[model samples]
Target: MLVSRGQQSTLLNRVKIEGRGLHTGAPVAVTVNPAPPDSGFVFSRTDLPGKPSLKACPERVSETSRSTTLEDANCRIGTVEHFLAAAAVAELDNLYIEVQGPEMPIMDGSSQPIFSELEKGGRKKQEAPRLWRKIEEPVFVREGFASLVVLPEERFRVTFVFIGPPPIGHQVVDRERDWEELLPARTFGWLEEARELREKGLARGGGEDCALIFSSGEAAPPYRLPDEPVSHKVLDLLGDLALYRPILGHFIAVRSGHSLNNKMARKLKEGEAGSNARKMFADN
Candidate 1:
């Protein structure tokens, strides 16, 4: 009895981008290829000779400390959340992401570039409608001060909450979903964390240009919007939900990050206990 929405669309053609990872700093070239209906989103690592490919889904998420990474026991790709977000926002169901490195170029540290690329690729509707995974019940999770609460809703929606040190101190975001409002939210980091990352040679590629860096709790560039942090969290959630393959139910976030996001994603996919909401409203 569940119905989907939107027409399945992909690039009318292929488009490509070459850059460096925001974290790994590795050189990378990623090509976006339009796919057939119901193909879903798939990432192929052309850099690997064997040409290992992984489906962009919660089950494929192997790591999420910095960004959502999709992988399997044999192969993997890192920091793909933004690109995936672009795909989801566009409501494009089928895509082939061919990459030559571990991370997609951190271009502007937002989904802007990816959005441009998606447009360049073009869109064409298929015969089928985009199915939605409407939450029939609520799914919740929490860790310390961070928490995630997803409740059943008629259409796709997201709510975000963030509370940390200054600069990003705290914020909340609420909206139905729009490309303009969501696409502009950029990635941010603290100065000390950025420095430590550099010393450890982890996110060496990350800098002021790719990500907004706050120094000692000061809004480095000043926030584009008051609730930018929460907006970005909503943005992250959108990208992650794209893996769900259709319209998603309501998603809520409270002081949550990639770690908790991935955990919830995995639980949804695995249908872990309490993850289902059928019983909650069964009688209603």
Candidate 2:
């Protein structure tokens, strides 16, 4: 259950899961397979001809409306943040995830199921040392009311704050000792937004079990903890950023969604590139 320092790891066995996609509502089956060291997380379209694969990297992201989507000429996969977050928390550095449909299964709109599956698979260290991004300076991005800030640290940490109208008013969640609290936090939205997404042919699988609905006079879904909405946002943020190597820093996020999370990830990558360039110049 412990990842050795300076060692890479992957699942010891393969695990399969089946559920419905949050956006497409199509029933899908996914299998998590162990990959060689340094492979990173990859998604393969098993149902498609030739089984095209896409690397789960932030630069591969093509869309982030409602959910994060990865796209390439051969395939596109949507709603991947929850699954990715589970992988990140598990310290799974390499994996081959095969999916039978266009989107990842919602799994009650929480990361719990995916994390459980990974736990069942266990973990085994590889020969290579683990890779990670070490932050050297503060990197920050802001878009009006939403912002993400990353400051240098020796380990990963996150804090999230959210503000919304009515029932969802002002929630903040601090990172706990482990990621367990974040796993059960389900995706949520306003009743009006749900109706609009349904009209646009989205959120087809969302319901009382898969998501929390905030509407006057309507019963809310069972909250796993207080301020679960903000917890879920943090879940999404962690997932989106998991595309990069494990990052060493403290991330402070405010009202950020999938789009903003991905933007922060890109900025992190850019920062690394800049750091490398400066190092090379000094060496020369």
Candidate 3:
């Protein structure tokens, strides 16, 4: 089991990254800076007028096709799962992310670069206690064959079962202490779907360097891990869960993606709110 930290933390210094969006293929720059306690994770669209900002929360998730996207009345941000996953693992409670484009840079199509940058910037504990949430009862969400469930646990854990065609038939990953292994696993896709996805205005920026592409029911040599695709699924799940406060539970996902993950997060947050309301009424 993982131990919880008593105090909140933020980056000690600012860090910047520049790359191309995996879907938009547009060049972008991102700067992550430390923020005051309780600030949570906030994103600002620096390229747009007024520099509109939005907090990272489950309710703000507006899109989840090929990636998780957040939007508000004034602005929208796409492909944020990688960065958010890194922050969750780094235990960063407060951060101000400034993006100079509509989508986040898909650096190497993995969370390793982002996680490394955050570590290089260092971390410092803040005065306030860390915001941790736990469920007293199981929270579950499902859609057809995909499902996600969170059960009460003393520490955070994730178990993912990936189901796909051909090259990515079926794979399972159970992660608890070895988060570093998941960071290096890059996003993947079938080579056969490249043209179709591009025609739909997606994966325009994707390339062999940024993603693992399989052809003729076979992936190229040099796999990052035994089952890299499944590991990436685990990474994406953690990022989606980050929308709510840090949770203490064992999350089990089967054929789940961003949409299902976000639904589970909203349910978990709603359950916590209801529990708090009951406690407040009893005290009154």
Task: Name the top lDDT candidate.
Answer: 3
Q: For model 2, how big is the CA root-mean-square deviation?
A: 2.9
**Highest TM-score against the true fold, candidate:** 3
Per-residue alpha-carbon lDDT of candidate 1 for residues 178-215, written as tens digits (9 for 90 to 100):
65567877888778889998998888788977877778
Off by over 4 Å in 1: 217-219, 272-284
Residue-level error in angstroms, candidate 3, position 159 = 1.2
TM-score versus the correct structure, for each prediction: 0.91, 0.93, 0.94
Candidate 3 Cα deviation (angstroms), residue 226: 1.9
| Candidate 2 per-residue C-alpha lDDT over 1-284 given as tens digits, one digit per residue, 9 for 90 to 100 | 11225788899999998999998888999999999988999999999999999998889899988899999999899999999999988888999999999999998889999899999999998998886777768889888899999887777788888997766779988773588768998888778888888999988888777887788656655678888899899899989999877877788998999888888888777677777777678779
Q: Could you give candidate 3's per-residue lDDT for residues 32-122 as a string of tens digits? A: 9999999999999999999999999999999998799999899899999999999988989899999999999998988999999999889
Q: Please give the distance, in angstroms, between residue 277's alpha carbon in candidate 2 and its true position after superposition.
A: 3.8
Against the true structure, candidate 2 has what lDDT? 0.87
Off by over 4 Å in 2: 1-5, 217-221, 279-284
Error of 1 at 206 (Å): 0.8
Model 1 vs. true fold: TM: 0.91
